[model samples]
Target: MKNCCQAPARRLFAYPPTSKTPTPSADDTVRPQPTPSKQNRGRPHSGRGTKRPAIPALPNFLPKLNPGSQLVMDRIYSQLLLFQLFFTGSVVDTIVKNTNTFARMRSEAGKHFLWLPLKAEELHSYIALVIYMGLLGAKNIIDYWSGKEIYRLPFPKSVMSRSRFQAISWNLHLCDPEDDRENSQKKGTQAYDRLFKIKPLYNDIVSACKTYFHPDRQLAVDKRMVATRARIGIKQYMKDKPTNWGYKLYVLADSACGFTWNFFVYEGKSSLATGKGLSYDSVMQLLDLSLLGKGYQLFMDNFYTSPCLFMDLLAKKTLACGTIRTNRRRDQRGTIRWLRDGKLLFVKWIDTREITVCLTMHMAYDGDAVLRRVNNPEREWERRRIPIPVAVKDYNIYMGGVDLSDALIGYYNVLHKTTKWYKTFFHFVDIVVVNSFILHQHLSKAQNKNPLSQKEFRERLVSELATQSSTSEPSTSAISAGEPCCPEYFGSDAASGRRVCALCKLSGLKVKTPMYCTKCNVPLCLVPSRNCFRKWHTVGHS
Candidate 1:
């Protein structure tokens, strides 16, 4: 023990103290501070161990949508055509098949179920009735079919029988039973699919949404809750949301017209964890890469705002702006502090309270002022123009896309109470309708025509979908024998070419044919199922 300490003590004492301490000079009393480099001189402290320039003015080159990629008319003039764009024949066919299969399965299981095989036309009528129900809300589902004078609705009774509507509602399925059973048996990562029951329908709808319309420059990402009290594992409780207890869905929508471009159901902790953070991954997942790199501007809130995500989006040529959490990075020591790193701008501004925002598209400052009414010392309200950052102004303007969508959906929400969780598909139906309505507005504006209100649009849509066939006898004067209109071959061959039937188009049916009226010079279907030629002649077209 003595030997172990002796060597260390000798080394420590090797340097002897000076005999007399040197006297301190005035010059040595205080160390000279080094001069700041040009890069950092006069820069304000950003409270994060770095100095940054004062908030700069708004940049000139704000991202604008490419001219060629501007919104063009989809050429879908009818409400039915726009609706069919999202709910295609394939989607309808799948629903019909799965619904029939599920009904048959129930019958085989000895359940007291009377189910006729579902047809595509009948299913369309059923959906139309559902939309109608949303418009005329009743206390109970049976009220729409009730014989009582106050409860009776002619539309529902005419479109579908009460028994048939109940049958479809009870057994409607979106995925095949066999496939779902097989998938359930899978272990580990594959076994637990929260949306397994409705995955097929969900995929088709999402794919169609992306394919049909490209979003404009300003887009927003937010979460929406589908109100439900069903005892399902995926149900979430968001206290701040109006529909507080329900299934949560993250939606990316157009800020201009509230068009839902893409959405996904929020599963749970296990499914959402992606090594990054939940907020970061959720935003990344909802965004389509094809839509990026095209001068698109994305807006979000504190939930999804992070330096990493904004940088990643910038790298792809997509601009983003949103409020951020101070705890996520550094806290601001003073009001209106900002930091600029390359193209990224971080702003900590105080309005009513503190608000931290991160944006890549806008400059840190622009001489913009927003009017705010404040109570003066006399206890009277007075208006004042407060300076607002450009980022804050734009964020306030464009961050409500999802909220706008929710408001529009709620106005005529088709969702009804149900014990089964899969019935949440009704929410998606409402989403499709809203998207179609938005597209209709855009198309109507482009064509210099007034767009129908949402109520009118849905009414027209329901009527078109509920109509059974185009060949329905037209209520018109009978054709005279002296009329020269007669059916003749119009195309070189039936398989080579065809055109839309004049009569069928008038009846809101998209029927194509190779036969034409000799004198009228318009195509008309001559097939056995659709005798548009004879029907057109019978209708007395000149």
Candidate 2:
């Protein structure tokens, strides 16, 4: 039997060294003969045909605009409007119902707690308060509601009571509790889903993200860590990531603005693996089939780059470029190797070190150079232009989209310290806010207006969500024909005849005042601390 590796070497050195010597030149200087070495070895012919294959032309990358995206852009003129796209009525109702059901279950199990059914309006306020807390970070959750002048945040207290917020956070559930038994029975089986607890909310959010915007020509795929210390099975630890401990998410984002177009939660071995390895399956899972064959360029890291994967992407009319591992593909030092198979180009180029890149969209080296500071013999650093591969240059430029998204999210992350694993939903809330802000910037540029910063966008969003009225009309009944029908407030001279203010009671405040509305015939507070009378007439009627 012959060694398989020796076949290439035997073919490379098939012609032996010749005994004949070259004649001297006119100056009687004999030219030296070139020697055969690894670096100067002649190019190997492609097995397909005698003619060298031409480099495939780069396809024009024009992303197909999603039809629904235009409708969303037209409808979303405000931060609240964009937010409502993700948190629709059905989404909020699901949260409200599940939270109430969980609280009821806990109450029935002898947990000593008051169980007031959560309303959709109150849930909105709760979410607003949570986002506010993230914006104004604190040392502790109770610090926002602290009585101390330095620690108190009036916005959170004004939105919802601290106790009520705590209650909702503690019992915030995504799925029905009764399904636990049925889920447990399927454990360790093929039907088991580790993410079933938050699957509905997760699916809804993912769908909304894909529906609202079409990504640009350049896109990047990578993984992010949502920091959490919870003792859950799905938690992962990545030493390379800034957040070493948390849930891992495979994300696909737009390279231009860092808009997260899609994401998949990593569930360890139980995740959807297509037998092609985790990295391959993760990229495939995050890619939208509708966006394929439309000339989009994808950039990824060495973890996801492979010959088979790049060829697969090329088959679908999508172009990709990424670094490869030495174990997966061999590299030679101080040499440039170009191997072409069909439309895919496999290049191994030497800069400071050898780098193997598999690409379908870029030439091996297009005379592009990048400036680098080098240490000279005098021990001084000098800027020098070094020739680089086009594929490597592009990979460096557009491969940080996921990292950019992670950085923006880290600015005002809403994920707080909580034992309840469902609280991870707050990470998704932060993602939604980041995506909305990116869209906001694009729309602002299109309309020739200045865009708000992420901080400003979140503040405006919190205000709208916290103060938005649940009902489009007034909760009060129409005034009768015989009623006073006047919409003004009147104060009685007798202060002793004070009654509980109607509007103040609804806002979790108890106040007694002699002021009454003439038309509605309801007692309302008129003091500076509690302006129930003016609020009732303004908000209740209008």
Candidate 3:
């Protein structure tokens, strides 16, 4: 019995040989370990009664963007436009240099040249003049230079001489003669080709807009009238506009800030080949496919809103809200009149405008909830319900972007009759200024900075462009002792190739000098004894 008791004590110290799990002692707590199974490959183990929630499915429509995002788009566009202008200005400067040289050569050959070559500074001043004329509301160029009795201050003559200004304005060429001729030859098929004289500038501006500026969620498309009575082939007439007779411009602008992102002048049947007419082509041109899939919304009037168009936009992942004409919609059925006041109704049907089928969306507001002030019997104004369609309300709210852009342009438009082409050029300048201002406002809001007003911005821009530093003294130590030369001394190389130095020739001396100062870009005597480069640049030369 003593030996059996000793055996039981030995069994307590050793574990039993079985596949079952071991029992825990009273002092220890047992925790369960997860089993390796295919079903639990991706998921981690949770404690008992704890469950993970299923992830929700992505909806068909993207969430509406915040208002701040629109401002960001505007800001980006503005910077791009400015960058394009800088490049354009550089190219123009080079062209002007070459043209001036050519003109001088022609003049020397005793050939009559109509266009006088202009300097970059002069071009800058001309741009400033255009802006100044718009802001001052001057009737003509001469009027601005020549102050009227009512005018307290005249345009400073020192900024740009009137004659020089006129010459530059009249001869402002954005392209070479060869390109203009080539473009003019193809003008019959392309209405835009008629604007080939300034087509390069136009293309640059358009490219800048496309690269940098994107419209906000809500975009508006409409026709704008650039006021002018000039007889041009491309000019269009819109009877409804205040300026009924002017160029018809199809504008794509942001609904929030009225910033014009892209535009094209409506020329005629050729431009309207898209079958949807002026409205459709304009919208297609303005629409960026990259922006479409991001849930952008387009707002247009009856002219652009068609059943097929709406479906096309929706298919591309864009939402459109607009007013539609009865003929524009293909569906004739379910066109019910809202007898029940103040209710919004939707009608959906298959659109069969063309041979192919399309999707159609229609919404109507009974106008019962619309209110207007009324004069009561007590002779006091009171709010009263006025029925207006919901479509009308939405249209009125979003359709004003084009109107706003027009207003901004009209407030200080810079177009006049020098030539029809000049009118286009000035119009472009107006666009650049307005777009720049929009960008300025956007940046200010983004950075929490104070923005300059449009007027202030223009003034600063004009000052920077117009001011050229001609007084950068020559670094040559040899020319420090000479008398200051006349302004005419620094003029463009003379037409007469056989000419002598003005100083040397005036002294009744006949001396030839091949050495021309690269800095001054003028011919001067660089003889061992008589160095006119030193004399010309110096202040006390004979």
Candidate 4:
């Protein structure tokens, strides 16, 4: 009551400036900066500061991918695959730099070694993948990446240096040990074969496919006998090694994704074509954990339908389904006595404008019970010599064996023989999936079985994270431990629509910082509640 009349005068004057910098915001915050000229204004300005427009909306993004290249002819070809091929093309460019040593690549293969540096400071294999990516484009991969940051690295230059040949030899050692570790030979005889299992570029292709595909669905093994158009070196058969005039490509792949996992290219003459077998060790090496599951199925053409191998797959609690070549007689074959399951396995005779296909149902042994007994030495001691004709030839001489009912097999077989014919089928499938997506997109149009919408899937993933965030252990190297673990790159986290971290709900706008977590090497924002900082994503960070 005493100061009421004079209070206005007391509040009239304000205090002076405090400090130059403002206090830090929450750790999760990345507060926006002011306009360029207004950033450090000394006092209020009526016309001194430059005005700026509001920030624009960001674009949308999605993460995760499929596998394969060539746009996938049906299930066999896919976008993920094409993307990978684009990557592999980069790796191939690395190897192509030294192609002068390999006679097979002697002819100028268009812009020979176009993107490769005449000299590099790092191992060719050590070059950042991004560089190769830029080098390999639908039209010109090198020209595309020339202006990118990755090309500026000194590693590329070091790798191309003559002194770094040791590294090239070392890489080849990982793929094949046959190469000379510390020697240089004339152009015609250079040990390019020892440097890499596949042509360098091809390995890049393989790597590219793997990044996009989900996992190895089923493993397929097949033998390709390719007669050369030149005076090729002699080699043993596909399996047994001695010497021959032709070469064979033993390819192993993920049945579900059609990504080539392992391929062995061997050269031999016909006289040396005696007995050769595929490399079991190589096949095992190429197996990707993504493809391995608690339960899995394997497929093979006639070449790998060995009785011993069959028993092994069953022992591993996995199923091995393949065509049984008519030529190979089973040791002990009596089918009617015991059979477990039967299904229609499609058979394709040819690949052309019009494809010829048929479905066949074959009886398969149900080794589910006492699977051990199938390979029990005690049970099979007498079965080895017994003649079993359980396996028979298909109508077409080119194909024979147990006709697997899987339509995927038929599609893969046709696609593998030649890719052009299968693409049409793939496009048709894409349309069907797209239409299905559209139907799911409109909730009202959905049938009793509602398909998940993009929003729904995102919500589900978020919910799953919430539950996982609580139960996950505090330590023990769980990816989700530190910051929300890692945010999906190119997914909603990085998408343009909103600057919110899909994971923590923190506005990326506030925490403009992009600090990376030391443990996981991921952007710190990905950490869910920093389950490491627990609640920190909310406001705990001091």
Give the runs in model 3 whose Cα sits over 4 Å from its true position.
Answer: 1-87, 94-116, 147-155, 186-192, 291-293, 326-368, 374-382, 386-390, 468-542
- Evaluation by TM-score, superior candidate among 2 and 3: 2
Worst 10 residues of 4 by lDDT: 5-14
Return the TM-score for candidate 2, rounded to 2 decimals.
Answer: 0.75
Order of models, best TM-score first: 2, 1, 3, 4
Candidate 4 achieves a global lDDT of 0.30
RMSD of 4: 38.1
* TM-score of each predicted structure versus truth: 0.72, 0.75, 0.62, 0.31
Q: Please give, for residues 1-542, the per-residue lDDT of candidate 3 as tens digits.
A: 22210101110010111111233233322222222333233322212211211212221444333333244433443332352342366665755764465455545554322233466656666676777777777675666555357653444455665545654554566776555656777765643366656666777776665444556666788888777778888788778778887777788888888877788776666744667655666677777665434566677866676555665576666666665433323422212121101111122222112111111222322212333454556798655433233444555577788888878788878787776656777777888777777767777777777777777777666655555423211133443245533223223554334335534643456665544544333456665788765665664222
Which digits, one per residue and each the tens of the lDDT, describe model 1 over residues 1-542? 12210111110000011111133333322111122343233333222222223443332323333322133575646888878878889999998999898877876674533345678888888888888888987867878877788875687767776656776898889989888777777734646676788887899889878766767778899999998888887889999888898889999988877888899998887554777688878888988765543557889998888777877777776778998766423322112445555555676665666677888776554445555565555797766544456788889889999989999999999987654665568998898898888878878877788999999999999999889423222223322345676677654778745777766654446887777765445577898898877775564431
RMSD of candidates 1 onward, in order: 18.3, 11.5, 24.1, 38.1
> Model 2: per-residue lDDT, tens digit, 53-126?
34577666656674224444434478987888777889888888888888878866644332356888888887
Q: Return the top candidate by TM-score.
A: 2
Residue-by-residue lDDT tens digits, candidate 4, 233-345:
43224344222323445555544333344444543222323233343333343444344442444555544544444444444444455443332122222211111111222
Clashing pairs in 1: none
lDDT of 1 at 240: 89
